[model samples]
Target: MHMTDVLAAADISKAVAAFAAADSFNHKQFFVMCGLKAKSKDDMKKVFHILDKDQSGFIEQEELCLILKGFTPEGRNLSDKETTALLAAGDKDGDGKIGIDEFVTLVSES
Candidate 1:
């Protein structure tokens, strides 16, 4: 999804308030919350590209699942139910997948 989608989905007031309570916001937190990680900006872009499997710049349900699986360490995978709930909570569009917009919105709420 386009970065503008994030602003559209987010509660700006809430995000600003939450931002105040944090020590800082960083790539690590952004990735972890979105169920991703990378060692550098380039690496992070790689992860984003992988998640955007269709090159549509929007991550569909299947891609979201794949991305989460890629990040989850061996033997530490989330239970089916847990994963389901997470998706349910974050998939704001009710489209069964989470685009970057939805992910940013969800994390901002948290």
Candidate 2:
């Protein structure tokens, strides 16, 4: 499944507006607003795959910086601090990248 199939353009716009208004990246709120919180584990895996742009089997910090763009063309890049926080949250094994299982767990728990 493709990202556009999961999150529509309207949803991406709404998320962008919210982020602009707040001037900060709220991971949980963004997920909730984008309907990601209700997605099944399998769906989340699909999302992880989509985000893993290099097919590296993991999401590295550099990719995390551009993660929002994976959702939409107009989505902004994450700030360095936001990227670091997100990576720290999901890189549970301390390998400095987020593996599939860790990605699922991080999103699920959020």
TM-score of each: 0.43, 0.90
The C-alpha lDDT values of all candidates are 0.46, 0.82
Regions of candidate 1 where Cα sits further than 4 Å from its true position: 1-50, 53-56, 63-68, 72-75
Instruction: Tell me the spans in candidate 2 whose CA falls farther than 4 Å from its real position.
Output: 21-23
lDDT of 2 at 110: 76
- Which tens-of-lDDT digit does each residue in 14-88 have in candidate 1? 323332322333322444444333133444455555557687766665554444333322212334554565678
Q: What is candidate 1's local distance difference test score?
A: 0.46
Total clashing pairs for each candidate: 1, 0
Clashing pairs in 2: none
In candidate 2, what are the lDDT values of residues 6-34, reduced to their tens digit?
76668767876677632388777777777
Candidate 1's TM-score: 0.43
Worst 10 residues of 1 by lDDT: 3-12
Error of 1 at 24 (Å): 26
